[model samples]
Target chain A: MYALIKAEIFKLFRQGKTYYAIGALFSIEAIILLSAYFQGTNIIDLLLENLKQRFYFEGTLLNGNLLVYLILNTLWFHLPLILMIVVSGMLTAEYKDRTLQTIMLQPVSKWKFILSKYIVAIVFTLLVVLALALSSFGLSYFFFGKGDLVVYLNGLNFFDASDAYYRLRWSFVSGALSMVFFSVASLTIAILFKEAAKTWIVSAFFLILSNILLKVDFGDNWFNALFFAKLNDTWQYFFYYQINWEQIHFNSLLSIGYSLLFMGAGIYWFHRKDIG
Target chain B: MLFSQVLLGNVFAQPVDPDLLKLKSRLDSIQSFTTQLTLSVDISFINMPVKKAQMMYTKGQKVKFSSGDFVMLPKRGLDFSLNSLLEYDFITVDRGMEMQDGKNCKVINIIPTDKRADFSIATVWMDTRLRRLVASEINTKKDGSYTVHFQYNQDQKVLPDKVTVNFEIEKIRIPINFMGKDTDIDRKKMRAAGSKTGAIYLTMSNYQIKTLL
Candidate 1:
């Protein structure tokens, strides 16, 4: 497993496209940090100001919570695109570039070959998310000056930078795992359709479909909690400074379940499928 | 400062009248009263210009303020109301005395009970002679502070025609264009954002008081 994973990592690094994903995430975060520092005024400030007229704000904007928010906003809609760009080509490249035949001739089992690729993809996805979180923090801190964390959630306020950091770290962990599941799902779709165009379409189709499914409110709290639509909500529940874990534990568990299910299916389909 | 310019100090010269205490006690005993108040919100925290909103306030289980065609329900999200601005809860406590506008006045501090309630504190200056609120210093928890000078009418049922809101603001320098309803609008959002610079002065010319229980 270790050797195969190492080989997969080497192959990924050899390809120049992986670095582009990192570059894009940094570029986007830099632009947003610049905008936040220079925009002078915006909706969030207005909302907070309106509240301040009546209450006191406890923390500073330079903390991890705001950085987390910035990452989520920057990557929210564009994540699937990032996954498609960097991940869709993983196995498909070997197949398209006629390297799969060479790999098949090796003494290693096919399952190891596929599992190595999957492990590499997951690790790559984690690294990409960590890069995003770090970039957001670095850029915002560069411009805004590092201070204590401040977050406004569900109309309540909380302070203390240390606690905020843990919340942010856990949120990043959960969010990064969720993104891996999404990337794996995309990779699975990429494998199913050999043609790059068909792979892109299938990947995008499922991404949009999952997003749409979550938005459907059935007026049933239990049902909504069960659906993956509450992914963002689940992140908030887990990472919020003062979270009522008991109330939203079920939803957080559901998010974990969905992520694992998607990843498992991706590996299952990828290992069993035959190439032309 | 009930009658700051009045010729005689008779308002206070008659000695602290026992009746005056009764009147004050009467007003105080009415822990919360439902009344219609007309106000102007003066935003003075921007350099492009000073902005103001004229609103009518109604108090009951909730406090509603209506300005122009917009009503803001402050207690519940960023809701827009064309008819009234509602505050789900407001709490007032007597914060002792203060001298303002060159006269001695009792100060009452008002705070919103809702966690998301916006106004941080409102300090009202009441004139002992007039038995009415004379001036108010409204401090937003997040931004600048504004002072409203009130000139009450004799009827005690409505406010005077001329109301002034004084603002203290800080200047902010930015490098990009912000998109709003108007492309060329820079100060609108800062005014909305309460960017801690500039002052607003409000003057009301006409008086119309409609009484509703």
Candidate 2:
């Protein structure tokens, strides 16, 4: 199983598409950083416009921590699409190149072979998210310097620069967990469809449908139970002051359960099929 | 006759309204006060909970709000001390008596002589019998215009039992990008958006007026 995972990583690195995926992340980060440099103050002004009526806003409002928060919000809608692009082809490419039959003829079990691809896809998702965090912080820190972080969730929230580091760290970790869910779901589609384009389409549709479902008013009790709404708000749990531990634990368990369900279904389907 | 002329001269040369002086002296007598207040804010598109806070004020423009959470209050309303207005170098002219809340009150218009005062003009209506401020229209530099109405209990202190503050706030503009491609048309629509008025109702109780010399 270890050897199979090692070979999958090697194959992923050798492909030019993998480099393009990393390159695409950096490009998106660069665009967001530039946008922050040019218009970030306007965004802060809009958020704090109501507060400004009473309080005299002093000190730095645009800073590295704020930039990361803004980037996270902007990328949440697009990061899943990028992950889908990268992971959707993970299994389908093997089928496309007729390498599935070659790999299956080896002494490896079908479950181990498919699980290795899923593991590699998870690794790729983590690396992309890590790069996003690092590049966004590095570039924004260089441009804007460091100061208090301002978030507009549940009204105006101000985090001192000293406390921002840990909050941002946990926020990125939770954000990566969400990406893992997307990556595994895309892999499931890849295995089921056996066609890269169709997998991409279905995965993209899932992302859009989940976003639409998030907005639907199914009442509080029912809406909170919806997996997509939970997934969409996973990052908000890092707001320690407003954290609902029960919801966070519930969502985490549900996400893990769903990922296993998809992977298990994929493995069972692939195991039963005769690939020639 | 010479002593009588000196006494009359001393009284006439003061050139200040005796009623205005009486009102200022009464306001200045209360050096400091602390009150427990419940503030309710109502503005378009902004929902805020009724905040209960302990407010402390000293005579020298010092004010503080002690609350567990963030407290938003109009600065002028929070620091609404008549001492601050009377202590400044202002020209006070009697605007004649008027009926306020069915009581005949003295109207005084105060224009600050200080070039750098926060407010340009303040029109005050005072209940002379009670020596309490009935209402004031203050035109300030940063806050535009504010009209504060005071409803006082028949207590010895000048502080009101309940205060209603009415002020105009510029409409907070939502970002164009957030509104999508209809931003330009939406902006035009927002431009035509009428006056946005905000009012804060403060009920003051448990007053502990302390005179710190």
Candidate 3:
């Protein structure tokens, strides 16, 4: 498994395509950074004026919380697209290029090949997410300086030292896992489509559909159970400070359940599927 | 005891002829006084349970009232004092019914020209019955449909002494059990603690009223 994982990572990083994706990520981050540097200060001042009326967000003007907010705002929408691109290419690109036929000619199990692809996709997604997260933290620290990290949750603002750390740490972990599930879904869709164009369309379709489905409330518990409706809101449970822990744990388990079911079904389908 | 002194006290207390003249004269003598006062806002739309903030103002009519971050001009051409009902153009003579507090009470309806003005109409129950201006009820408009009652402290009317402004509005009900973190344990003890979220008492205590030359 380790050798297969390592080889998959090597194939991914060695490719010119991965570098192009990284370049795109850098360019996007730079544009956002410059935009925030110029406009974020004024927006932060306005937010402070409004917040002072309701919550006590005590600190110097440019605080850590403000920086964290800017990063989260920028990456929330963009990161998913990046994940789709990276994951779709991992398995489907080989199939598109007819390289999968050559790779299968070698002595390797179909299950191992699929597992390697999944693991590689997971690693790439994590790498990009963590890099962006860390870079955001660094840039925000550079510009705003460190102060108490305040977050607004449940009609209340949290500023306590311990709570902020707990929320950030848990959110990061849960967020990474959610993205992995998303990558698995993308990989599955990509494999189904032999052509690259179809792969992009399918991945994009699910991304949009997931977002739309999240908004529509299905009152029926039975139907709601079947759909991964609003997984982002489920992720928010970890980030929000005042959440009832027992209930939050239940939702977290539900999210993991969705992710696992998708991955399990994708693997089963791919194993049964003939390359012809 | 002198007849005049006894008569004067009765007149002031009952606000009959002599007492009425005295109260009006006292109000007229002070052309203008500048005072720093705190105004607390309690509105239903505020969303929060309690909203308390302090505002300092220099009031005059033409009333140039400036608080820390806001400046508003009250309509009726501005030389108005909430202290004197007549000064605010809220006074009228009801000859049929005698004024209760005594000098000679009037039944007058005051319409504020300022559209943004907080209260819709102030129907003053005035009396020249005392040393200063007497009793009054300032009914304010709420949400264009509901009326909020603000009853003033009639007995205590002077600068520096706090006047209690009583009010009652629609009751705000929120769930008792908090879903989030356990910041406060005592919150668990209560079944559901309900209070008037819309009612706020503005107590104006100290006034730095200054007269301009």
Candidate 4:
């Protein structure tokens, strides 16, 4: 298992797509930081237009914590899409190149072979998220400096610097879980399709469909809470003044269950897959 | 000072009432002063903890507010001197006596003679015994009406230790672009909550006054 995991990690690093994923995350961060620099004030002005008339605001609301949060919002679409493309390509590219057959020829356990891929995929997702966190925070603070964060959640939640940092840390933790699900699901899709281009299209469409479904209100709180797509946005719940630990915990556990379910399906399919 | 000039002159042609002059004179006595204050917002939609800020006020200049934390201050109410309210030429009519917050106070209605003034009219309830403004309602030309209630500690008669400012603010109709499942926003509720009559409570202490009469 250890050797198989080691080889998989080695393969991941050698893959050009992995480097592209890291580059994409940093490139997104740079664009966001620059956007936050020029247009962020206008956005803040619009958000506080009503309040600005009545009250004078002291201290900069557009700061490191706020920029990080804005960057974190990309988890809803961009981040996961990128994760899906890269992780799915990991499996599909192997199928295309016949590397899966070469690996199986080594007398490796089928469970370890596939599970190693799943573990590596999860690790890759976390690393991408971590790289995202580091770049977003480092650049935002370097450019915008430290101050309080004002968010338009539950009607204008203004958090001090310390509180904002705490919320941001947890948000990334939950956001990474959602991204892991995408990576696992994408790998499962590759296992099913056995083609890189076909897998990418299916995964992208799946993400968009899931996002669209996430917004469809069922009008029942229990139903809404239980919906798999709705669990994707669990990270955003932390910005609320009163944090909902139960919902976060439940959603986080549910996210893990969904990831494992996809991994299980991938393992099951890979176990029976016949090579030419 | 109310009724500063009758017609482009500095002095009023008629004798101004001493009571109205006393309110302005009481505030004008301090050359400048600084105080630490905690401001709490009481709007149903906005949620924030009390912010600690230092306010600096000079007689003829704009009030300056500074805080290490983010602070929201009512643009009109923080001017404790009532400088803006009484700056331009205005006439005071004795609206007679009224009981305000259980204190029998003299009601002075000030109608601004200068079109440049932000307020159309202001009604002040003066605590003649304490020689201070107990409460006042200022109707601005554009920013809506503001009602200020001042509470002074007996020991610190010059400045009110506490101030409650009530005003009507335009309801916030801005869309929240936040992402999350729990962020199911009811636009109907947001519309209902957008505009509201809110109050800002200011607790002032740690005074550093300079050059008092």
Candidate 5:
């Protein structure tokens, strides 16, 4: 199992597609940072325009914390798509190049082979998210500097520099859970389809449709129960001054359960199939 | 002897109404005050929790708010100072008696002599018995119209214990440009949607008033 996982990681690195995925995430962050460098203050001015009428807003509004928050907002939609692309290719590429038959004929167990792919996909997802966090923080901090963060979620919410630092960091950390779910789900689709194009199309459609469904008002609990909606809102948990441990625990459990269901189904289907 | 007595009585009665003079003196007695206030705001499209803050005000127009966390207070309503209104050159006219809150109050209109004053006209209802301003309607060029109602305690000082401000404001709409579309057009649509009338209820207590005389 260890050797299989090592070989999988080695194969992932050898492919230029893996670097492209990381590059894509970096490029998005770069564009946002550059835009912030030139027109960052304007964005802050626009958000604060209405509030300025009622309150005298002092201190730095455009800063590292705020820039990171904005970047996360953009990443919520784009990150899943990026993960789907990379993870879907993981298995489909094996099937496409007839490498799956070659690997299956070897003395390796099929479950271990599938598990290795899943584990590597999870690792890749984490790395991509880590890269996103580092670049966003590094670029924005370099350009905008550090200050308080202003959030208009339920209403106008302000966090001082120290509070902003911890909350923003944890938001990214919580957000990685959702990426892991997406990675596993994409892998499942790739195994089921066995064709890269079909897997990509189905996964992309699923993501886009779930996002649309998230906006539909289907009452309270029912709407929140949708995994994509829950995934998108995972970052909000970190905003609480006194963290709601019960709610966080519930959401984390739910996300892990969903990922397991996808993995279980994928493994069962792959094990029964006659690939040879 | 009869003519001289009539002349002396007329001289004693100044052109400024004695009631207005009493109200002015009552309002001027507090040179400064610091109060701890809890503000509850319910405006359209804005959800805010009860905010507690320390508010300090001087005889001049200097007002400041300090809180451990961020507090959002309406700029117009919270700065309630009769002195600030009276600072400008204005002509005070007696508008006769009117019943307010089941009490007979003397109504007076203050018309700004300077056209460039912040508010064009202010109509104040002063409680005759308490010698305190109970309600006021201020029409301004910039800020539209505002009506402030003051509820005072039975204490000797004339400062209000609570205030409710009713004002007309442009409706609050978050300007979202859908997919980088024209925001100006969307803003125009939002504007054409019309304005709203809102109120802020402020409960002020723990007053540390600096007695000016």
Candidate 6:
């Protein structure tokens, strides 16, 4: 199993699309960083325009911690989409390159090979998120400096510098799990469809549908229990003035469960799949 | 007392109340001051921790307020002296004597003669014995209104130990990007909210006051 995982990692790094994935996320960080630098203060002022008349605000709020948070907002759709496309290519490439047939001829079992792909999918997703973390934090602070964070959640919650840092760090950690789930789902879709374009389409549709349903409260408790889509926003719970740890735990565990469900479905199909 | 004060008003008194004169004179002698300030906010929309800042004030100049972290203070109540209300020429009408803060205080209503004044009416309850303001309220033309109460220390009676500033502000709308989709903002409360009231409780210590005398 360990040898199979090493071989998958070797193949993952060899692909040019992996670099494209990292490059795409970094490009997004640059746009966000530049946007924060130029227009962040104006946005902050416009939000507090009414309050400024009645009160005098001291110190600055447009800082590095805020830019990191702004980048985290992209987790809703942008980051996941880029991740799914790249991670799915890992499997669909095997079909296009005729590697799947050649690998099957070896003594290695199909279950172990597919499991190795799933593990590599998670590692690749995490690496993308880590790159996002480093560039967003390092560049934002270097350019914007540090100060208090003012967010409009719960009627304008103002967190001091240290508290903002704490919440944002945990948010990234939770958000990484969400990215991993999408990557795993991408691979499973590829296994089901067996084509690169179809996998990307289905995965993109899945992501969009998840976002739409996350906003709709069906007034039935069963909806949330059945769908793991809304659970992706577990990171946002940390920004509440009063943190609800239980919800974070439940939602995070549910995301992991969904990832396993996808991985299991992929393994089952690959074990029975015939490649001649 | 009201009848006699009204009778005495036209008979022998000057244009302004003696109480306002004494209160203004005692406060006017102070050239400058620097103090450590702690501000606690009490408002529906704002949630902030207690903020510590340095406050400096000199005669004929605006306050120089500074802090390492973000802090918010109400523009109306930070200065307990009501300098702006009293600086312009004003005539006072004494509304007899009332017991305020356990002192036999004189209730004086001041109407600014200068049209440049931001406030239309200023009411003060003064403890003329100590020459300190027990309570004051200013009704402004544009910035709504403010009511303030002061608590003084025995040794440093010149500056109040604590002040509570109550003010009213109109409802304000926030832009879309600032108020993302997930926040719990009650639209009903927002539209229904008229001029809402908020308070800022400020405590000052480590005073380095310079009085010109």
Q: Score the docking of each candidate (DockQ).
A: 0.04, 0.10, 0.04, 0.64, 0.13, 0.58
Model 3 lDDT tens row, A157-205: 4333344445655665666766776787888887678576788788877
Candidate numbers sorted by lDDT from highest down: 4, 6, 5, 2, 1, 3
Q: Which residues of candidate 2, in runs, are more than 4 Å off?
A: A50-55, A222-224, A239-241, B1-90, B93-173, B176-213
> Positional deviation of A196 in candidate 2, in angstroms?
1.5
| Residue B31 CA displacement from its true place in model 4, Å | 0.8
Q: Write the per-residue lDDT of candidate 1 for residues B111-146, one digit (tens) a residue.
A: 655567556766667776666556766666654566
lDDT of 5 by residue, A1-276 (tens): 899999999998898888898788778877877777788777767766655554454346678887898788754568989899988898999999999999988998988899999999889888888888888888888878887676654334566667778888887877788778888999999888999999999999877776676555565675566455555566776664446667776777787788888888898889988784
Q: Report the number of the highest-DockQ candidate.
A: 4
Ranking by TM-score: 4, 6, 5, 2, 3, 1
lDDT of each: 0.54, 0.72, 0.53, 0.84, 0.74, 0.82
Better of 4 and 5 by TM-score: 4
Candidate 5: Cα lDDT at B205: 96
Residue A166 of model 6: what lDDT?
89
- Candidate 1: where is the Cα deviation over 4 Å? A52-68, A147-153, A156-160, A221-223, A238-241, A246-253, B1-213
After best superposition, candidate 3 residue A167: deviation in angstroms? 2.2
The candidate, 1 or 3, that scores higher on lDDT is: 1
Point out the higher-scoring one by DockQ: 3 or 5: 5
Q: Report, for all candidates in order, the number of backbone clashes.
A: 20, 0, 12, 3, 0, 0
Higher-DockQ candidate among 4 and 6?
Answer: 4
Model 3, DockQ value?
0.04
Worst 10 residues of 2 chain B by lDDT: B5-14
lDDT of 5 at A243: 61
What is the Cα-based lDDT of residue A90 in candidate 4? 82
For model 6, the superposed segments whose C-alpha errors exceed 4 Å read A220-222, B1-14, B99-104, B177-179, B183-189, B192-195
> What TM-score does prediction 1 earn?
0.56
